[model samples]
Target: MLRRSKRSSSSYYLLRRIALAAKAAKGEQSRCGIVGRSSSCSCSRFLTTGGIDDGEDDHDASTSSSSSTTLIKKRINDEYVDTEAAMERTRMKAAALKAAGLKAESMTVFDREVKRAHRDRAAYLQREKKEEKEKKSSSSEGDFLLEEATRRVLDRLDDIKRPFKRILVIGGATVSTVKQLLEKRRDVETIIACDSSEATLLLVKDIVGDAPKRKFDSFPVEIKYVQAFEDDLPIKDNVVDCVLSVLGLHWVNDLPGAMGQARCTLVPDGLFLSAIFGGDTLTELRIACALAETENEGGVSARVSPLAHVRDAGNLLGRAGLRLPAVDVDTLTLNYKTPMDLVEHLRMMGEQNAVIERRQTIKRSTMELANQKYVENFSALSLSNDDDASMPKPSSSESGISATFQILYMTGWSPSETQQKAKERGSATVSLSDLKSALEEKEEEEEKK
Candidate 1:
């Protein structure tokens, strides 16, 4: 009997272990049975078949046992259902928390990345500004050198001797040159200086001083200042004996019209002498800007235009109806230490103004970036071997702020014998065939090139 009891205990323990294992595999919590004991006695009763002793007692006992068994089975099923439901709720809560944490981390990373980008952009803009200031200083210096060279050349021309009765000086700022010429020519009876700026005329009057004016006696000289545009000199045709201009024609908006007025003002044999700053004045600055834009890999504003260089002054003079026209153009180079210094000189000389239409103020960041790019691209080429290897090198034109310019000096007479002959030939007729031929020729030339 003791051995039989031991075997029964073993069997009960094995059955309980199997039930627990099944519940755990389904993600359910452990639960006690209806018997309120460690072993599953009620479950064992269902597995075994047995008979009753007396009829009435058997009937009552059997019914009671059956009812208890049914109650136990129902309790076990309920316990399993509750355990599974609780586990599912817990799993869902954990997943929600994890998702929220990941979202917060992503937001933090995104904010940091944005801040880093802004800081880098600001740094780039600052670097660009420094470069721009350096470039401007170099440009100004070059301009000063050119102006000085021009002054020297003018002085040489002043030494020549000439006689004149009537003289027209175009452009008013050059009052000093006119004053010197007046002092030299005792025979200059009447002088007219025409210019667009009223302020310039006033300055000229002050510079001329109180030189006595006479009509006919004692080497009479009369200086008259007229406010007029280059294209429309307020003088009658063939009224002046000589027309002279220096460093002013480039300012004229209408070069052709100005030339016509100049020609009309002079007598048939009247002389015309003029000097103009032609296209090559600021080649270095132009080239550096272009190269910098290419290096930066960006587009630049169209406000800057390449200055027009005169290819043939003789042709232009002839087109203006000048006789015995002679055009001579030469290049001049000038240098400066920095761009800012050059700009200051231009201001003093009243040449710092620009004609381009623009906004009153530029974006600080954009300007800074432009300057940096300019310096980075052009600084190396501007250096010279003589520059100290240890010392910091400049960004452009190693010979300080060097600039190249073309000085177009021209001399001619008003419409004379040759001009009259051409006028008499009447307008040269051009037919539709001629127009077609000209267009075809241009296209062929372009293709060949």
Candidate 2:
């Protein structure tokens, strides 16, 4: 017999294997009986008549099937491994994020206890000063800022036509706001004065004691004092008709939470009003201190407590579930003979930095350096004309440093069915682009008439 070519022999073996596999897949036969081309098997004759080496063909066919099976298994294992790795990565990332959130929640910004202690200490120091004085000063020189803010706050209350039977005041340490509310507002029958410091709350007791005999005698309104943190009020929900906080709220570490708590005390359609120190309150002092610290210590520490910005006040109110939110600003600049006088004024106001990370004491060298910077950069020869003409005017030749206090006055109302709701978007029949033309046409008609 003639020897077959290597390519033809391999092709014939491949055809024979395909026939065997197909028959096995159909379950026609469990085994193929053809061991070689010479065997008289029916499958051998039908598969291929070409002459070929049986031994080598069997070896090659077995090797090809085993290799294909191994490749398929390897591919399946690779896909499974890839899926497991991705899941592990996702789990690790989720764990890291959860830990980071917990860390952020535990971090302290403004220490409420420290701030309360400072306010209490200030109250005691003021009492000592009063006991030593021969006569009480008629002018509230140290508390003029608070007085101005109080006046503005009351003016806003006056604009509202509705009467408030019950009012809650937070951080009314000076007690001027309470006196004004009792004297002016006939609708106000009960007042709840609250403060973080127990000593500060004690100051409101004078208001309670003198309520019956003073100007409020004409309208006997009940005044009660409560020692409570701004962030955690003791009052029940929807108890007060109006809530007022003057120069407070800024010191709270969790301002949004505190504002929500304040809102919770208000009744439906109740008012939420406050005057907080804006971010620009102590611009000059902040800059001077920052520069001095950077020059001396090669780094800066928290010398001033962070205050809210005018732009953010409205959003904060809405976030606390208040409606009809409004925010405005009132800026005041005070001229100080020296930076030290400014420091003393802050101490009197109990507005010293209570940040948890603040240094215990500022260095004498840094203080001197900051004073130099303040005078050099913010010196004013004469005070600018201000609306509050009662403030002492600087002499034409005298030079002093100026400090700016930007007060943010915010007002928000509790949600109620009676409150006005904004019109839906794209529901207007007229477009603002045509407003000017419409106004012009109306003016023409008016002129013709």
Candidate 3:
């Protein structure tokens, strides 16, 4: 009886091995990357070659003559392999563009914007040290809004529990965020800063110190520079733990597409934060320009690029497949002595007019009239103590005016299993009628109280 039981147990083990091998082979047939079913890829063949399962040869090839289902799987597997190979080749070629290539066809104005941004940033880097000295001497400031917005986003890092091991800062290559990251979180291990211009990355070396990898005192942070377009990121999916964009994403031709790329690059539940100019930005200037141009040229030309509305930011984030998206605005009302002062400040911030439809130059007559209209419409009083007067009057032509900037800060997270999921359709425990009745009862209880 013991000898018979032993024989039966051995037979059962052999059958189980064969069953598992067959099941694995069936699963292998449906997946991508078959590539003519090399022996290494097919489970049945692998098991056969390994001397584990000798009952079956290559399942599809051997069974095709007798089985219709086998022939169909073989055809589907071939197609899947071919499709996967083509996609991989295309993806590699896309990554190659970062070194020397082109933007995607969907990004219409992106190439042009990239060129302008590079030119502007290159000039800034070359003269940054000299300009700082000059700015100090003249008591004039620069890029206050950009730096301020960046720091504000940095302040929220405490809220994120996970360490950002791989960080991608899009369009903020010149402005180094490494120092702040090192100081705030010692968990930073790798920071990949990318921009359209090589010059910006060149200057970043100076800020972050020499070599590709930078060490902040004792902290270890590997920083790499890549010349990449905003819309076309040469990065693998779900590789980066964090993505940050400061005053840059708004310039992309296809904002939604860029956001989608960001979403894909981030790991599950990874953080993405950005601060961009909202539609309300430069309202005074937009209004003044329209009023001036309409009065003079009988129509308005494109003096400034159109900014995105705050209402649309949440929808855009959601469209990009990001979960728990949040959008808010911070209005910065800067006091400039004149409208031209605001223009100079904008130039210093690298915010020169780069829109494709922008006029070569605002007509001198239109420009002067716009300034006059701006002062009349938005100028604030520079209160001064007068010996004879109780209160000061409105600011003169030389007095300060308010230049409004609505910085829209948006935050989103990459999809994760732990995040809340919406209930399936028709699966709700309570019906609409039940919810209405419950609300009515609550309202009645409130009335009694």
Best model per lDDT? 2
lDDT at residue 65 of model 3 (Cα atoms): 37
Find the candidate with the highest TM-score and give its number.
2
Model 3, runs deviating above 4 Å: 1-115, 118-126, 129-142, 172-176, 211-217, 381-398, 424-449
TM-score, cand. 2 vs. native? 0.72
Clash counts per candidate, in order, are 13, 0, 0
| Candidate 2 clash pair list | none
Q: Per-model C-alpha lDDT, please?
A: 0.47, 0.66, 0.61
Residue 288 CA displacement from its true place in model 2, Å: 0.8
Task: Give the Cα error of residue 366 in candidate 3, in Å.
Answer: 1.5
User: lDDT, candidate 2, residue 36?
Assistant: 15
Runs in model 1 deviating more than 4 A are 1-162, 183-186, 212-220, 292-297, 302-308, 352-399, 418-449
List the candidates' TM-scores in order: 0.49, 0.72, 0.65
Per-residue lDDT over 148-171 for candidate 3, one digit per residue giving the tens place of the 0 to 100 score? 667667766667776787787877
Candidate 1 lDDT tens digits, 1-449: 00113443365456547755974665422121122111111211110012212222222221233332221221122211122222333355456657677433332211222222222222222223334667787421212333343353345445445555777777623554455555455567667766554334444454454353432344535565544445445456677887777665665544655676788778886777777777776555555544445445465432232233666567667777788777766665444454433333333333322333322343444444444443444332343322222322233345345444566777777866644343345466876789999999999999999
Candidate 2 C-alpha lDDT tens digits along 1-449: 01223553465456547756974674432111121111110011111112223232333332233221110111001100121222343356457767777542254588777787668656655544444452665433325667678888999999999989888888744466776776577788777777776556555453334433225457666655555567655556677999999988888866887788788778899999999999998899889998998998898877888888888998899889889999998877777788877776676567888888778887888888988988899985355336565554332335788888898888999889999998989899988869989999999999999
Arrange candidates by lDDT, descending: 2, 3, 1
Where is the poorest 10-residue window by lDDT in model 2? 71-80
